[model samples]
Target: MEKRYASIVFRHLTADRLAIRYPGLRSVPFVLATPMHGRMVITAANALAAAEGVIQGMVVADAKVCLPKLVVMNEPPGLAQRLLRALGLWCIRYTPVVAVDPPDGLLLDISGCAHLWGGERSYLKEIVTRLRGKGYDTRMAIAGTIGTAWAVARFGKASPIIANGTEVEALRPLPPAALRLDPDTADRLIRLGLRSVGSFMDMPPAVLRRRFGGGLPARLRQALGQEAEYIAPLRPAPPYDERLPCLDPIRTAAGIELAIGRLLDTLCARLAGEGKGLRKAVLRCHRVDGKTVQVTINTSRPSASVPHLLRLFQLQLPRIEPALGIELFVLEAPTVEDTAPVQEALWAGNPGLEDTALAELLDRLKSRSGTRAIRRYLPAEHHWPERSIKEATTIAERPATAWTTDKPRPARLLATPEPVEVTAPIPDYPPMLFRYKGEVHLIAKADGPERIEREWWMESGEHRDYYCVEDQHGKRYWLFRSGHYREGEPQHWFLHGFFA
Candidate 1:
C-alpha cells in the first residue's frame, strides 16, 4: 500500500486574534507580548510593524513608541495548547492516527484511509473545509515523506503539490529553506550561489557532506524521498468505548436508557477483555440536530460489572433531555484502571461490598446537589490544624494510605475556622475565657501550648502557639495565638478548629 500522510501547519498561530479580526488593525501595527526575564518580550510582529523596523525580541515599550496604535495582548500558553489539541481531535475525522506537532501543528498518517474519502486531494479539501467551518485558517500538504510534507506545508502554496516519482524536479525551484535547513546553512547556501534546492541537488553528494557535514546530505536525501523516512503513528488510547447507531432515532427516556444499557454491556465486555475497569465513563448522545449532550458518571473504584455501571447510568438518565431525538450513542471511558480479578471466598456467597455501588449512591447525591458539594478529605503535610485537611473531588482517585502513623492529628476538623477572642495573663498560659461565634465560652480546662514556628519561605507566614481547651459548655476547641509576647505586637487569637 502507498503510505500517505499529511502535515497541517497553522500560520502565525502564536499571534492573537486582534491582528486578524480587527479590520482597522489589519494594516496597523500589532505585536504579541510574552513575559520573559521580568520584561515583556515581543514575540511576533505584523508586516506593517516590520516595515517600521520592529523585530522579534524587541522590548514592548519601544515597539509601542514606534507604532502608537500597536495593540498588545498577553500570549496565553494554555490557550495555545488547547487550540492545538482541539485541532488534533478534529483531524481524527480524517484519519485515526493523528499526532500533535506541538506549539501549532499536527501530523496525520492517512495511509490506507484516503480512499474512504475519495483520493488524497478530496481528503485534503474535506479536511480544509471542516477546519474552515470551525473558523480555523489552515494550510495542508501531502507528500511522500514527513520532511517533504512539512517543507511544502510551510513554503508550498495551497495547490496540491504531490511528489510521486520526480521529487527532485518538484522541489528544484523551491528555496534552500524548503529543505528545513538552519538559518546559517541557508544563508551560506545563498552566499555560495546555491540558493535553490535544485542548485544544491546538482552538487556532488560527497562535497555537500564535506561542506555542510553529514546531516545536510541526509536531510536533503530525506526531503527528496531518496532515503526512506519512517513515521511513528500515535497509538490510539485504549478506549472503554461503546457505540450504537440507531436506525431509528431515540426520543423517549426509556428508549435512551435501553440503548444506554446495551452500550454499558459492550463497554463492560471490552474493559473485561482488556483486564481493565473504568473509573469514569462519558455518554455522548449525538442528537439529530447536530448538538451533543454528554452525561458523565464517576466510579469510586475501577469496575466493569454491568449492574454497577447500569446503576450509575440510571442515576444520570433523567438528566438526559433528548430534544430532537438522539441518532447515535457513544459511551467513552475518559479514565480507567487495571482492576485485579476478585477471587471469591469459597464460603462467602457474594464478593464483599462493591465500591461501585457506593459510588453510584454518591453520584446520585452529587447530581441532586452540586458536583462541588461532594468532596473527599485528604490529609496534608502540616501540623497546623487549619492547614492539615485538604478537600478533593470525590471522583478523583486518592492514595490508599493518606495518613501517617507518626504524626499527631485531631480526630475532627472544622470545615471553616472559627474566630476566638482571648484574654490571657501571659502568652505561655491558655485562655481562661474566650468569645467564639459571638458566644462567651469559659475555658475550664486547658492543654499545653504547642509552638509551631513560621514557614519564612511561604507568603502567609505565622508563628502560632496552639492549645486544646475544653469550655464550660462541654465543647472542645482548638485555639491558637499568633506571634509571641516578646514580639512588639499583641498576640492575635483564632479558634483554628474543633475536636470530636
Candidate 2:
C-alpha cells in the first residue's frame, strides 16, 4: 500500500498558548520573551504583535518602542515542545500514528486513516477546524511522503493535499529551509544563489556533497521520495492489535459488549489464520472525559476461540466504570504462542489436559475469583518431599517422573513445617500425644517412624523421622522429628501436613 503523511505547523504556538490560558490576551498584541545574555529578548510574537514592527529576537525594550502597550510575558524553557507533545497525544483520536515534531509541529501517518473520515479533504478539515476552535493557529498539509508534507505545510501556498508522484513539483517552489536543513547549510545554499529547492534539486549529487556536505543531498533525496523517511511515533502500534472508533460515545454495557465482540472476532480470525493463539489480551477504553480504563484476561492455554475468550472478558465487565462514555476501543494481545491443530473425536471420551471445555472453564473461574485461586502441580524427580512436586508451567505440560504411590502421602501439604511439642515413650517410638497451635491431641492409633534422609547435595540438613498419627477424633496428621536424640540437645518435632 502507498504510504501518506500529514504535517501540522503551529503558526504562533507560544503566543497562542498564553492566549488560551488567559482569554483576555487574545485581541491584545503580546510577545513571549526570555532572558538572553543578561537581557530579555523576544522569543515569539502573536499575529497582532507581528503586524507591527515587533519580531522574535528583538529586545523587550526595543519591542516596547514599536508597540508601547505590547504585553511581554516570560516564556518558560521547553514549553513549546511540551505543548506539542500533549497536542500530539490528543490527536491520537484522529490517527494512531502521531509523532511530535519538535518546536511547533506534529506529524501523523494517515496512510489509510483518511478514508474513515470520508476523504483526505474532510479528514484534514476536521483536524484543522478542531485545533482552531481550541484557540491554536495551525496550518496543515498532507502528502504521499513525510518530507513533502512537512515542506508544503510550512512553505507551499498551494493546496493542502499533494497528489502522489508530485512530491518534486510540490517541493520545487518551496525554499531550501523546508527540507529541515541546519541554519548554516540553508544560509550557505542561499548565498550560493540556490534560493528555491528547484534551483539545485537536479544538481549532481557529488557536486552538491563536495560544495555543501552530505546533509543537503540526503535531505533532497528524502523530500523527492528517492529515499525513505520514518517518524518515531509517540506510541508504537502493538503487533497483535485491533481498534474500533465509535461515532458516538458508548455509555451502556451493551455498547461496550458489542465493541468487544467485534474486536475479538477480527482479532481471533487473524490469529487462527496464522496458526497462533493469544495467551494474554488487554481491552483499553478511551473515554470522552480524557481518561482510559482497561480490562485484562489471561488463559491457561493459548486460545483463539472467540466465544470462550469473550465469555472470560464478560466476567470482568463490571470492573470497568464507563464515566461519561467511551469514544474508542483498543484490543491488544501482548502474549501470543503458536498452536497446533487438535483432532476431533467421534465419540465422547476423557480428554484430560487436551479438553478445550476444561481449559475454558478454568479461564472463566480464574477471571471471576482470581489468578491465585487455582494451581496445578506435577511430580518432580526428587526424593525430598518439598522438592518432589513442581508447579506446571502450561496446562498440557507433562511430568518427567511418575508419582510414587508406595508410601502414604498427605492430601494437603504445608509449604513450610511448623514446630509442635510431642510426648513419646522412647527415642524411636511414635508420639503418644502432640500439642499443635496450642491444641493438645491424644494419639489413638500410630504408625511406624519412617526415616527419610535429606539430599546432601542440595543442602546440609537433619534427616526427618515421619509418623502418621490418628488423634481421638479420627483426624490424621503427618508429624516428623528432626535428627536423633542427643545427650544435651532437645529434639525438635514439627507438623508437616494433614490427610483427608
Candidate 3:
C-alpha cells in the first residue's frame, strides 16, 4: 500500500489551552511569559495579542509596551510538550500510529486509515472540526510523506491533502524554512536569493551539503520520498489486528454483537490459514464522542473457533457502553499461539482433555468466573506434597513426569498445614485422637507414619512423618508430625489435608 501521513499544527497551543481553561481570556489580548536569561520573555501570545503587534519571544516588558492593557501570565514549564502528548493520545482513535511532534504538533500515519472516514477530505475535516470544538486552533495537512505533510501543514496555503506523487510540486512553492532547516541555514538560503524550495530543488546533493550542511539534503530527500521517514508512534501497532469502520454509528447490543461476530470471523480465518490461534483478544470500540470502550477475552487454549470465541466475548459484552455510538471496532490479538493439527474423531464422544469442546467449556467457565477460578495441575518431579504438582500453563501442556500412584495421596491438600493437638501412645504410632479447630475427633482407624524428608537442595527444613487417619464418623484426615519425636520435647502435629 502507498503510505500516507498527516501533520497537525497547533498554531496557538498554549494560548488556546489558557483560553479554554479561562473562557474570558478568549476575548482579551494575553501572553504567556517564562523566565529566560534572567528576564521574563513572552513564550506565547494569543491571537488577539498577535493582532495588536505582540508576539512570542518578545520581552514581557516590551510586549506590555506594545499593548499596555495586555494580560501576562507565567507559562507553566513543559506545558507545551505535555499538552501535545495528551492531544496525541486522544488522536489514537483516528490512527493507531500517532507521534508527538514536540512544542505544538502531532504526526499521524494515516495511510489506510482515511478510507474509514470516507476519504482524506472527510478525515481531515473530522479531525479539525473535533479539535476546533475543543477550543484548539489547528491546521492539518495530509501527504504521501511525513516531511511533505509537515511542511504543508505549517507553511503551504494551497490545499491540505497533497496528492500522492505530487510531493515535489506541493513542496516547491513553500519557503525553504518548510523543510525544517535551522534558522541560520534558512536565512543563508534566503540571502542567496533561494527563497522557495523550488529555487534549490535541482541542486546537487554534494553542493547543497557543502553550502548548507547535510541536514538540508536529507530533509529534501525525505520530503521528496527519496529517503524513508518513519514516525516514532506513541504506542506500537499490534501485529495481529483488524479494524471495522461502521458507516453508521453502532448503538444497540445487537449491533455490537454483529460487529464482534464479523470481526471474529475475519480474524479467525486469518489465524486458521496461518496455523495460529489467539490466546488473548481485545475488542476496542471507538465511540463517536472520542472515548474508547473495550472488552477482552482469553482462552484456556489457543483457539481459532469463531463461534466459541464469539461466545466468550458475548459474556463480556455487557461491559461495553456505547455512550453516543461506536464509530469503529478494532479487534486485536495481542497474544497468539501456534495450534497443532488435530485428528478427526471416528465417533461422536468426549475426547478427554485434548477435546476442543472441553477447552471451549473451560474458556466459558473462566470468562464467567475468572482466570484464577479454573486451573489444571500436572505432576512435577518433586517428592514434597506441596511441590509434587505444578500449575499447567496451558490446558494441553503435558507433564514432564508421570504421577506417582505408589503413595495414596489425598484428593485435597491445604497450601499450608494447620497445627493440631494430637495424643499418641508412642512416636512411631498414629494419633489416638486429634483436636482440630476446637473440635475433638476420635480416631476410629489409622494407618502410616510415612516419613517424607525435605529436599536438601531446596531448603533446610524438618522432615514430616505423615499419617492417614480416619475419625469415628468415617471422615478421613491426613496429619503430619514435624521433626523427630523427642522423649521430653512436645511434638508438633499439623492437620495437613482431607481426602474424599
For residues 396-463, could you state the per-residue lDDT of candidate 3 as single tens digits? Answer: 78888887889868988888999999999987999999999999999999889889999998899899
Quote each prediction's TM-score.
0.53, 0.84, 0.89
Q: Number of clashing pairs, model 3?
A: 0
Q: What lDDT does candidate 2 reach at residue 193?
A: 87
Q: For every model in order, what is the number of clashing pairs?
A: 0, 0, 0
Off by over 4 Å in 1: 1-3, 12-16, 23-104, 111-119, 133-137, 157-173, 201-206, 221-266, 282-296, 300-302, 305-311, 314-351, 354-500
In model 2, which regions exceed 4 Å deviation?
11-86, 238-240, 270-276, 334-339, 342-350, 425-428, 451-463, 472-474
Better of 2 and 3 by TM-score: 3
Instruction: Give the candidate number with the greatest lDDT.
Output: 3
lDDT of each: 0.74, 0.91, 0.92
> Model 2, 408-460: lDDT tens per residue?
77899998999999998788899899999999999999886889888888899
TM-score for candidate 2: 0.84
Weakest 10 consecutive residues of candidate 3 by summed lDDT = 342-351
Each prediction's RMSD over C-alphas, in Å, is 9.8, 3.8, 2.9
